[model samples]
Target: MKKFQITFKGQVYELDVEEIGSATPAPAATKTVAASTPAPTPVKSAAPKAAAPKAAPTPAGAQTVLAPMPGKIFKVNVQTGDSIKRGDVICVLEAMKMENEIMATQDGKVSEVRVKVGQLVSTGDVLVVTA
Candidate 1:
């Protein structure tokens, strides 16, 4: 058996360890002592801010493109009145440390761009409208 002292996060602890032979299993044990310093005061967090407003509903006969996942708009490749084809890269989404290309699902003229660069978006959030 051996005794050792350990300091962590400004707190001190004492430990006791016993050695066992290869054929014998060691028993688990733990001991804690009251800290000498007073406990820290709890911090109060500020209330969460309201989320950004979503874009207005799509115009009649217009097809809408939505975000595939929650992420920041890294770049916008197309704008309102721009013509697009199926599979065209519409914007770049930065999610999980990766830049994903948001593509057009069908060919059409962009009637509205609902998002801008650096805007945070969530899955199924309207991003663009086409007609």
Candidate 2:
């Protein structure tokens, strides 16, 4: 059994909880002996976790630009066949009452404008495709 102390609304409470694997009930004699003895404190251990690999910033020859966050496309600045350079604003997205500029990560000729103005897009949704 585990003992816990909780404070709520200025009131304090003491609670006892049993572990899941310990399903059997204690005998009357054992219960009495346990009530007379104090319980031991628990210790916690921390372990480091490995970081996950990230996707490539720019896709191959024909690349698609994805939305970085969930939002509605406020405006699309480019069309098919448009020439663009790195870091050029491709669209304006509105999310959480803020406007965000979606920029091109690499220089390419836009082959597809995947999303339209006023369209709702989610994180990682394709916004534009470049060739």
Candidate 3:
């Protein structure tokens, strides 16, 4: 057995290690235990909470625009009753640090905006509706 002192991320640790001669390779899993003082409890605050924006309901038979991937809504370009054409960019979505434009598929008036700015959406989640 050998004693060694190691410092990681400004924390010091003392470890005792024993070497065993073996023909078979050792098992793959390993664990580490750290001995330290417990972290302090977080302070509670009395600040008021802001209300999260809600997603609007999708209209029946309206052309539904869905998100292509999981991301946050970066910007919304269309509003209810806004005229849009096919291939027109209606919103911007940020996913994996990339900005993606959500476009209109058919010429129509925007019937509903199903998502809001800064909202997180998953793949195939409804984003907009046109009629």
Candidate maximizing lDDT: 1
lDDT for each residue of candidate 2 in 21-104, tens digit (9 for 90 to 100) = 556864333344477687865543334445655543555668898999999999999999999999999999999999999999
- Using all chains and alpha carbons, the TM-scores for the candidates as numbered come to 0.60, 0.54, 0.56
Task: Please estimate how well model 1 matches the true structure, expressed as its whole-model Cα lDDT.
Answer: 0.87
Of the candidates shown, which would achieve the greatest TM-score relative to the real structure?
A: 1
Q: Rank the candidates by lDDT, best first.
A: 1, 3, 2
Task: Candidate 3: give the clashing pairs.
Answer: none
Identify the runs in model 3 with alpha carbons over 4 angstroms from their true place: 1-57
- Which of 1 and 2 is the better model by lDDT? 1
lDDT of 3 by residue, 1-131 (tens): 55677665555567977657966655655645566856657444434445766656666777899999999999999999999999999999999999999899999999888889999999998898889
TM-score of 2: 0.54
Q: Report lDDT (CA) for all predictions.
A: 0.87, 0.83, 0.85
Residue 11 local lDDT, model 1: 56
**Candidate 1: worst 10 consecutive residues by lDDT?**
40-49
